[model samples]
Target: MNINSSICNLKFGLFFHLLFLSCSNRDEVKGQIPNVLFIAIDDMLPVLGCYGNSTALTPNIDTLANQGILFMNAYCQVGLSNPSRASLMTGMRPDEIKVWTLKPHFREEKPNVVTLPQFYKEKGYATRAVGKIYHDGAYHQDPVSWSNPSVLSVTRDGRGHKYVLPENYMPKRSKATTTENANVQDTAYIDGKVCQAAIELLNQLTDSTFFLAVGFRRPHLPFSAPKKYWDLYEREMFKKELKNPRRPARAPDFAFHNSNELRGYEDIGELGVIREEKQLELLHGYFASVSYIDAQIGKLIAELKRLGRYDNTIIVLYSDNGFHLGDFGLWGKTTNYEASVNIPLIFCGKGIEQGAINRSMVELIDIYPTLIDLTHGEMKSSHDGISLLPILKGKSSKVKSYALSQIVRPYQDAINSRSPDSMGYSLRTEKYRYIEWRNTKNMSVFARELYRMDDALSEKENIASDIKNEALMNQFSDIVNRIRK
Candidate 1:
């Protein structure tokens, strides 16, 4: 697990990709340049009607998916918020930025690395952001990346701004309820205000070609939303036994996160054990929060259409990372499992194909260059992601063979300033999600797991130990080894 050596090996691929990103191969727009509407949803997985989640009510996202291409196998570079967004916004992997943990912002590693938005700003696009774009911390949010002051004020510890009811807001009682179906307007929550702010910004920028990033913070924790959204699903829906409520069969313990993020809330009570009935409540809250965010998106979409920017603007909706709703007995994202890495990526409006489904493997990092390619031809830059013009143009089925995601285990509880003993790297292909847990000191693979990834429950067990799959295992191993060389 000599992680440092692996980091050095990653540079080989990084070097070539950097060259590819800096090439001038874009076609200049003939008229008004296409505006970019970047919508980022926190902790959102592909649980909408378009993604085939029967229980979740998300008409706005489903409708947006119908307007363009929906990528079925999109992934994030890391599971944690700060690291995941850092890698994506910079169009680089976590290893290249040396940001394995939340602290020491990506800029600390590469001081002058131009972010996705910053690159657009340099190109004369009015880039502005609202809500959780880059972790919302003084250290994590790079001030130089924005053309105007961004609006973001979140209680990073998952404590406040989660409840609308006065009784639930930092109550003197033990802990606040994990969910609040409050009878209040949408503006009572932070996400509602964020959506409003974005709409106002859009109104002002309708006359110009602006890159507006509207980020919504919901369905992440405390699952608080308007009661109307909560009424969308009946309580009986979550009571049915959740499929695979336990870890994968024979999967290593290191492969799962501690889930301290979910357990930290007060009403959750007992960090170790949660009752089945309570789990159902949490599930209901998650669905309702998703619906709540969907409503906000509906409003944003309507505003865009009203302003006449819908036709000429490119709306790219994606999440930093996927969440686990009792999958593998894991409640949150911080693992290499399918539920943690698989995200919903939809590209719509202006230069994007209509009503098509792309089953190719793509990463969050590819988005930076994809926008550049669609709007004004991608420019020469320091990014490490390849432009996805081929896939979007329907010329190629896929841009990459597999998606890569990695995480450092035993690094969840920060503030103590702890380091990981092992690093896990997982390669996701069309057929399988393979992982190798290696020693960070020696760079030797200590444990391995392989999932068929054919269906939802295909990851319920690991099949790498079977001799029949040894050839498949070696083939995946070679891909991982090649990156190190």
Candidate 2:
């Protein structure tokens, strides 16, 4: 998992793609680029209405998805927080940037590289970001990128919720709530602040086009929201069980283990247990956060409509990465399982056909080039992601046949104490998921997993023994090799 290797791989792909396009491409159109409203969510899974989850509530997102195209098979390049965010900003994969964990800062990886916002700025769009748009703890702003950036004060994060915790309520790690807030607020977390800022910009900025990146940080960890959001769901009311009782039945032996940290949480077993009641509570909090965030989007859209910009703006909503409520005895996203890798991605507005759904395998990295296509015909031909513009325009069968997700350093300091740095790479298609880990001491091969997504629960059967699956294994191996290099 060398950073240089990742960069070289991206550079090679960019070069090859550009070479191919230059020789065969025809009929490229350039036009008045539509304004972009890039809405990003933190740790949000596809629990929205458009994704077909009846439990979760999200009106604004659902409306947006209906107004345009919904990407059913979108995924993130990395599973963790910081690296996932960094990959989106740089249009580079996590491995290429060598940003494996939350500890590393994006600045240290590629300070001079052009950021997504900076790219828009270069092309004359006023780029702005508010809330927890970057990594979790990153403060200030990317001085080289944003035209306007605002972050909520620490006091905002250390606030109390309007809802009361259970008599025995406590965080998973510590004895009690570490942060407290005095303000009774909506958009309580960073995303709330971001929404406010975006709405304000829409009112004041008279510019015909702008790049607005509004990121919300809720539904992440310590899942706390305002009391109203908490009150939205009653724990005693939830009766439906997980679609699969035994763990999704597809993946092989390697993909199903908790991280050392997760094991620690479960071992504490005091709080954050994935009990049915707790799962209901967590889902309630998540839905409320999404609903709260959706209200903000509604405000932004209203402003756009009032300003006569609604029809002209292209709004893309996506989650940086997915979250696992209690799937596979897991609470967070640090693995390559479906819950951790597959994310919600939807596009709306200007030139996109309405109510269309595409099941193409696409990654967050494709977003960079997709915008480039939407804004202008210019594209970094060397990038691994293809512009989804074709799919949006109803001209292509799918964006890519397969999506790739990778996780490096599965355990911070838990497994393989001698060699350290055990890594896992996964490939997801319309039907299957395959994961491979090395330098690890796990029963599943050098640490391998293969699952049939049709039945995602019921322990991922250890199919590593079935010699009949050789062709399947090779196909996945080839994808991993290309992505790894």
Candidate 3:
């Protein structure tokens, strides 16, 4: 048989298996498949109260953690929003989807691939998307993935709200400020509007099985939140606990950047490191944004309860990728660092353990298969990640030994005096992080980074060149080579 025929046969077999399982477990599931409440947060790190960050005021998220299984070692496939979302949604890797940048959509490369929501839709689930479900860019949202058109109300131009910076705060990059503590209500922002829309949808849902995806676009950039949220925390409380550390001494030159994303705003005028005072302000804005988003989450959960869908609905909360707030002098993602790749993932609902924290290493791609297994839906295609249902049901304590993440960078070559494209492949095992930067053009290795995962501070130190790690480096290099192939 041909490739298409083989896929059809596999799907046909899986469909019958799912049908049999669904019928067998009909009593356990109340004769109905569980609805899905998918929540996506943008550029959020694991800085919630449940994540052990005392400074972060996230009661709603903490409550969710108490009611769900929180994966303590979840990592994104990539450190950028577009690529990370595409990879997770399609159950593929960045390389498989060929979406390394924000400019291209995954369909451009894999038009026939079924996305996570599209898979649910195929299995008779009404899928609805609101806010930034996919990347909020031109040609980024996948139309076929939703039962209704995705709702988007915000513009890329910072929502047209003019920000007012502090007095005598001269920006070095652009005159436009990077933060806005607007004195408007929650509904005045896009995320607030998204919450309202989601609540309305939840109230109006008539389908037995529905996949409602609510994406929040805050804590990403411009750090725009209502003044009330800003008032929740004192500015002094946002002081940096760790001094801005220098980049890893043995790190490759391509591993660092001048934080181009933050500098693009008009309020930022320079390409250098931000001052200490400004860093404090940024931290306050970031925390405020987190709290603001947390409030919206509270609204969502409350609505879910009001609609009487709280117990039966399978709720999954995740961030596309982690963000950096001046850690290692980098203010944005796209690095092979812990701050950029380590994200938050929580799953709560039917069949999941409550108040449990699993320390097994997991990746965003595992979400698609896990949802499929939980919903007893047929999988028509293969996925880069395996189903995490075993771990959720307490049947297994581990899924995979390591998680992989990659980032593409432009490397300036001294011999050729020209910049060539390179790919950084990182492997995160239980106790170490090994990264190999390879010149994509010629497939030659440029640099390597091996970090001992004893603590957070170990991420800032590169021990790849240390003689004591030669054997470990060789072992990790072999694994990375196989992964690259």
Candidate 4:
């Protein structure tokens, strides 16, 4: 009887120890999961304090960078809105989805694909989005993942604050009617509305983890901003350096060509002709719009801190795509230029190393896998992009040495144009940029361009003449072959 009692006591001791170990294991797994707060800016270039653009007033983004890893060389798969956003969400290249234009819906093209937000939702996150998370305000958020999905503009937010625009703010020849409500102050743009909605969503949260996407729309077109923002930059400052900008001779003519929207004004019989002073005014307005967006970001960041979710939430800020601020004498995004492709991407949150600037070549497509890996969410399907987790943590040394971009402008491909039937492919590296154009019929209108970015402003110089550098052309061709496959 004494021996049996002693054995029973030993068995109970082992049982208690095993129970403790099981509890500890569950706690460990729970602690590893993280919340995500993804922010997107529309048509914004890397003209921020973090990206070495001293003139940009982006205090909120700069502060975010101070606490996270800022990708200095991050680029989009394509420059346009639909393709760039689609590629990032689905982990597929634009060509893979056949989404080169703004009109086709993403889900319609790739019906069975699993989006980043959908993956997070499957992992028990209550995913929500406000404002232009996708392009053109027409693409709705996936209903399965997003609750209270909307793309709202601040002017119509029904908020208490009164927004006012100057009487002369409207363009003299704009087709849009100038009304009391037509022009919204830059500080009062759609992003402010989105931020308010996000605050409301967070306020109602409970035990469930959240995935919130806040999209800001400003500084894209028409260059509309409040009078105060316009006061930030002087028009006289822009008048000092007017000169004819030249591009690389070896680069295709399409590289320097403006979009059809700009060229359509030529046949309007001087009615829509934009004067030089007017162009400078537009430039000033763009700068003001950027500053206005920065101020709105300041508001959102404060709200996050107030909720006590600042430390635990993974904050990622990225532009849907980069914009062309009159580079190469071009006014807008439709070309495969570096200015149009390169975007600013910053990640700050749990396990993200602070103040680290990664110069490795990374694309928007990588964002999908990176988020999955960070959250330990289930991988839905095979993706063309690998996770940027190792690179973000400073664990992996490099992401990629080369990046590719493409252009498929149907309007520009019409018959008898300078670049008739145009489709071009570009390759970018740490030190150089190269491109080759092809028509719809598959004719090689090959133009070899080489630019040394270390030089001032990366002026397009035709280095094809230099016999010593013949290997670069072959390298570009090989990249095209791989991308096509």
Candidate 5:
């Protein structure tokens, strides 16, 4: 062989070897990115066995909590479904996205903003959503967020006249009865269908990293579940803690509502405080629905395990927002109160500490940055929430000292005569909850509420009018004002 030819061949061989090594390293990094299993529940409060709710029969969720870090102080940015979901998915606050109400789609305001799943999809991960990841409506679904088309099921109870009186029957909107204990299988409900779809996707996933979001719609409204779940709890076993509780002292009338969401059913008449006897039945149905959803979650987790994807998947289970369950004479969300904001957040699987309970304040928007940090994905847009990766790894105890939540009450004089057009901005620190109700039109402070966290009736007592806590109230007001601008 000629010496020149041999030299050229050696150089070509060395170049190919270097190229192979670079490609191999890239593949290794891609393989190391763990799969994400995001489970979202609607209108779920922090009432679970792991969260110390003895009445909550959530063995699957409790098991997940035991195997993960249960965030004790995690809260939603807003209490409403569309606003809260949009905030977390976009990693932006409601103000930034301009999505404070259910009417406006987030994309309509920020058309180019990338969502959490879309971000993962951009990072070469296959993203799919089954069930109620976004709001339950068709307009709420984002087509750009998934690799394939998103799958959604009917959210109605589907019992029809079987559970309600024929005269008062309105299919999905009968107010005559709120709780339906249908004698049917779990698959008869929408959540069950969601589970089945998720399981099918899990079985089909191979040779690719994925972001599978399974959102369960249960324990939300109407409190419908299988009769077996209701059979798990006795009506006598359900205890009513606060019957006909008065509005918070010194709290603005705008802070309380007539449980309008609960009264939407045809069977339910005019808006009023639910009677104690009926409250027990509703509570039983809520718990029963929770248990039913827990069973569905168990099925999903079992499928992941069966597919050998449990260990390598990053499992995140959280709720969209908290529910009132008749707190403060309110039966729905949309207030800045703890019952509406505090949600259950659990992180399990790869790259997370197990059995760790974090009490530090965290927001739902933080989920976006946390997942980005975990997968080493790049962020193309700004985010209001800080990453909780340090807290998840036990490197830090707290990310932010305060978590903020807000709600806007539109001009609805006919619907809610007492709650005029106002905006409720609440800030929660480790020791206090400060709320400011501002006029929506003029942006002037209408009323204020201050509650010490150490008090048993912190939310029940509004110390904004107390002269003794004037300094503390000023400090909180300053914080809220700074953020407001």
Candidate 6:
């Protein structure tokens, strides 16, 4: 434990001792501190039933939105899993964490940096994580963040199992098929078993004030889900033509990737152009996976209500990054575009204004301080994010001008930790998404893009250098330079 954690524990012990002498159970102190149920979905965008998407079959998530504050314009600091998760969990920027890739865990960069869960655990909360909370690998997972042994999918609970159908998993091919649907129970796959374990953990956490992180791995790549979820929607629904199916005009070549993440599967292999028919199949799979995750969330919430902990627990649901399903001819995340950065963020619990939708922008980094402030705990350490507590209470309409999200170009799953060729700083504002691509070596402006995303997809045009917007381009440059420093 660090010095701050030691001091908090000392104070808690003294308070508990005095309460015990007065014949008061620990519940008096613990009950006042709300339990935290942090839910993380893998690669989900804001296209949910609550987010005004009629196509998605996310009734459970929609119901939760009816009882919470929904952030219509929330985003991640980084558009990749490792960097994004590390940034949000630590309340730090990707540059501060020095974790811009899928390898060399966050601890490798900031070893003793207290994570969000560690923050709660330091203040006498039983912080436990279930499923894919951190990243996928065991090396990237942090055990010190939890107060007890975490039920991680990386070990066997959920993250390891990918496919339900034997044919989908071909050892002869060295990779599984991209999508699958089995007529088996939900527990046959990863997310179902993860939810089952989380429900079981909830039963055991009755005595302690807990920060339980239930991470659902669905709507991700190789989009696998139960057959019933696939049956909920007609596959033809996903076979629609897109308005802008290519990269934005005037955008640099380095700004876009080869959609290589999806190519690792058996079917898609280094194919430069994805067939239209295959794109529909992938979209259908993605939607099915989302509904499957929603079902699991419904079950978990039912368990919370059954245990009578629903009202006292703060439920935070968010995705680490938004996904691109054939948008701009991209099939995955790791982009600074709005489709890959703008994500769904909902806060539902006691003291939160219910059914309120906020258009103001916020970052995932703010989750750390927001939760601490809600629980009335002392925040001893410094972090890059500010608390959204006031917004949660409806005291303010806006707190940030833009939710910043960035990406390093020449993108690769295992990032080239050595300074990249270029880095794009994207500022997502109310009506526009402004990007400034800087040369990494000398930090010189190499490219720029400004997309007016009020009524259409952002990839239609890049207006940064448009002659009419000369003054606006100069202002955007100054904003990027100030934030980059």
The TM-score values for the models, in the order shown, are 0.89, 0.81, 0.88, 0.81, 0.89, 0.91
In angstroms, the error of model 4 at 160 is 14
5 versus 6: better lDDT goes to:
6
lDDT of 1 by residue, 64-138 (tens): 999999999999988778878988898888878877676768887799888988988988889999888888666
Deviating ranges (above 4 Å) for candidate 3: 1-31, 153-175, 240-243, 377-381, 411-420
Q: lDDT (0-100) at residue 293 of candidate 5?
A: 92
lDDT of 4: 0.68
Question: Lowest-lDDT window of 10 residues in candidate 5?
Answer: 411-420
Better of 3 and 4 by TM-score: 3
Candidate 4 lDDT by residue in tens digits, 1-485 = 69899899989999999999987875555456677888888878888888897566678889989899998778887777777787788888876776666655568768888787887877777888776677754443456546445535223222212223443234343322111232344336455566777778777653447788888776666455556666776777655423234565665564555434444332222233345675566567667777777777777778878877777788889987776655566656766777788888999998888888888888777788788888884455567776788887889857677777777645443212323355667777788776666665665655556666655444567676687777877877787778642
Q: Indicate the TM-score of model 2.
A: 0.81
Which residue ranges in model 1 land beyond 4 Å of their true spot? 1-31, 153-160, 171-175, 271-273, 379-382, 411-419, 455-458, 483-485
On TM-score, the candidate that comes out on top is 6
Clashing pairs in 1: 1-439, 1-440, 1-441, 1-442, 1-443, 1-444, 2-442, 2-443
Per-residue lDDT of candidate 6, residues 1-485 (tens digit): 99999999999999988878665655666667799999999999998999988788999999999999999989998888888999999888877777777765777778899999998898888999999899887777888999887785474322337775667654444357788878878988888889999999999998889999999888888788888999998878875523247778777777888888898887897867888778878888888999999999999999999998998999999999998887888888999988899899999999999999998989998898899889975565568777898899999988777778888877863365545667788987788888888877788887788888888655578888778987887887787676542
Name the TM-score of candidate 1. 0.89
TM-score of 4: 0.81
| Position 158, candidate 1: lDDT | 36
Candidate 4: RMSD to truth: 6.3
lDDT of each: 0.81, 0.68, 0.82, 0.68, 0.82, 0.84
